[model samples]
Target: MTPRSSLAATAAALLILTPTPAQAAPAYPDPQPVTGQQIIHDPTVIRLRTGGYVAYSTGGVIGARLSRDRVHWKDSGNAFAEPPAWWYEYNDTGDPWAPDLSHRDGRYWLYYAVSSWGTNHSAIGVATSPSGLPGTWTDHGKVLTSETTDHWNAIDPAVIRADGRLWMTFGSYWTGIRMVELDASTGKAVQDATVHHLATRPDLPYAVEGPYIVRHGRYYYLFASYDACCSGVDSTYKIRVGRSTSVKGPYADSTGTPMLEGGGDLLLEGHGRFVGTGGQSVFKDRGEDWLAYHYYDAEDDGTPKLGLNRLSWKADGWPVVR
Candidate 1:
């Protein structure tokens, strides 16, 4: 071969061997369109047997909103006419945060967290309502609590039943997500229940919080919010997920990275008008799974608003927000 042709062949070989940079992951989809009474935070939504949908969120003594078509919502009122006296023990203002709503035993169970900002002295309280409507809840008091000395912060309670046993997962920035067994009859923690650590960051000031677990097929998927929240447009909150074969997980992400070691698959994040998408929960409505969360609206002065998205599953049983 000619000397010039030999050099050209060597250059072509080097080009084929050099690796190209990986493409960025696709942008997350926006929440489905919702209208009216959209302002909310850390929202937990459920369908009532009587019909329509009721959403309870963190504000105004557990604020309530009702929707007849799931597209439009109207302010209902606070879940309680007055704050339970016990709430004052944790916070002077008697303010409550993230709440989880569910139906069991022919009644509605409401679990909520009360705490002051930047402290671990928090408690998760439970209330029951026959009608699951505003102004009808009967406070049953604190289910569990955490002190400043404890490794885990008690907040963001989410419950799931697996293998005929009730389990409650709750935690915050202290150490990350932790779970404890709950007595089905009382909706409270079982005596000396095991506190299982689910996920956390390996670095200082672990920022993971707002955990919700759902049993899909043969695995339990743990969804959690990562990074700072409650800062309106400046919040860095996003959602991540991991799954385990057992309810009390050694949960790991899609790449087989364990959640305990700062591993989580990025499920969703801020995009355009929807900023700081976090504080998420999942529930089924009419046989279709839905993701209920809160996001700060960039177009509306950074007001936090309710966000709803349909959840579709892949063939591998992993969830995708549609």
Candidate 2:
């Protein structure tokens, strides 16, 4: 209990308890770098039942790809359904566009669009696989078709189930975002009231497609990519959003403005070597969320490719891939 001994003990205690000023909190979410596959487009990521990653995209001309990590990709090369012998248009861009996927009752369902830009002859088709990989698909025929340049048409297909109802939202140039009800068990359109627009456009991009619908918190967030996609460096793709209380319609942007009125908040724009990026699907993994999509890589010949980034939500309620 000497004075000198007590003084030494107090100094050591203060040294142990002292905190560094550099331990400040982050003002923004930390951006995570993506281990991207060069030129992979139309990214669709699924968390398998066994806690593995399965990503599909506009891969091989005849098949999809499977990947454990987001970076390395391998083509399954399994064709669940061959290009319908009926298909004749599209120049040569066959079996491309949005991929709507879900896992239900131990089975996986995939719906994709078949269309060429500027043509209303597009159709949305359904495919199923027991395992969420390629080649095991069962093409369930054409689920929906679009007007032949005469009407707002079907293109991008996005499906989500909420409130005891399964809904599919899709569209492009002709009208805009529209929805349809699907049988929970059979996965077929159930309601004749299938056609409904999700937004209003005074000057929104005419060829708006790539509709990805996800429910976050109490709001259903509809994120759609706008502008011309697949144009390499000249692409003008961007991500936009609208939220609604109902899974169905009347979704609005952050300003309480209807998405039809162009109320969506811009989530991402042209950045980095990627100029145009869209065709987004949000995925939840490892208790975190991510944005899976594609973009044109300007650094590498401005080729349209796949890009996956983690979607971090801000305090302000906007989502971004960092």
Candidate 3:
């Protein structure tokens, strides 16, 4: 054999006999810089089947943007030209926040939040579209809601397929994050489905939100934002993650602390002018994982702007934004 082939064969044989060393999670990389109409909050991104990508964010009628490449973006307009009438029942302004996008059976499912700030009375609504373009969605009204008496606030919805079922997770502040099985046919919560309490922090600020779960290999990773947000530069938001073998966890961080008791591995934090990097959603584009979120731009007067980073998992199974 040639020297290169002999070296490769020997390495392969060694790998077969030697146990792989644990991989240390890499440090979070600087956010990929993108410009043009970047103001957005609670962004979720998806690649269009035709070409390019679209990101839906919180604002009047659910603001959206389009990008030919993932880096440079332009405003595509809002999902709804006019706010859905039913949304006014939950909030007078009828604006939406934290839209989650999922694809199934050649259609797109969009779940968003409707509520007045600081109130437990909130609603999570779903909209459907054959083409995930601006103004193509049909409102499906509220899939779940919360009242003053309810322990959980229904918002920031994310849907994933796990255990051969569709599940939607939503919540914020009041009682942390929650999940329930969804009816794949109707894109609604399955009737009589038990709501599963996933993660929480009962401490004073009670700040946990933006739950996004994805099943990778044998483990389900739950990603969430913790601490305060929405105050621009003063925002303290950071992204954290936990993993469990089952969808309904007892998820824990690398240190084996339960997520329900404030156990989470820190995945991303503010650096320099990027303050409060949180409200993240993970998507695979062209076979590589990417994280989409909003961060306060300290140099730009703390304007909330869209941030993107490549996500990589260690050999030990911990995710890191690199």
Can you write out model 1's per-residue Cα lDDT over 145-228, one digit (the tens) per residue? 999989999999999998999999999999899999999999999998889999999997999999999988899999999998
**Per-residue lDDT for 139-206 in model 3, tens only?**
98889888999888899999999867889988898879999998998888888879899999958556
2 versus 3: better lDDT goes to? 3
Q: lDDT of each structure?
A: 0.95, 0.73, 0.91
Which regions in candidate 2 have their CA more than 4 angstroms from the true location? 1-37, 59-63, 78-81, 86-94
Report how far off residue 119 is in candidate 2 (Å): 1.2
Q: Estimated TM-score per prediction?
A: 0.95, 0.82, 0.91
lDDT, candidate 2, 1-322, per-residue tens? 9999999999999999997568653232222334444456777778887656676666453346666665566656634455654344532746566676778878998877777766778777777788877667777766777766445666778889899888888877665778888787777777564577886466644657778888878878899888777788999988888888888768888788888776787887777676787888888888788887777777788876666678877786667667
Ranking the candidates on lDDT from highest down gives: 1, 3, 2
Give the best candidate by lDDT.
1
- What shift in Å separates residue 309 of candidate 2 from its native position after superposition? 1.6
**Clashing pairs counted in every model:** 0, 5, 0
| lDDT score for candidate 1 against the true structure | 0.95
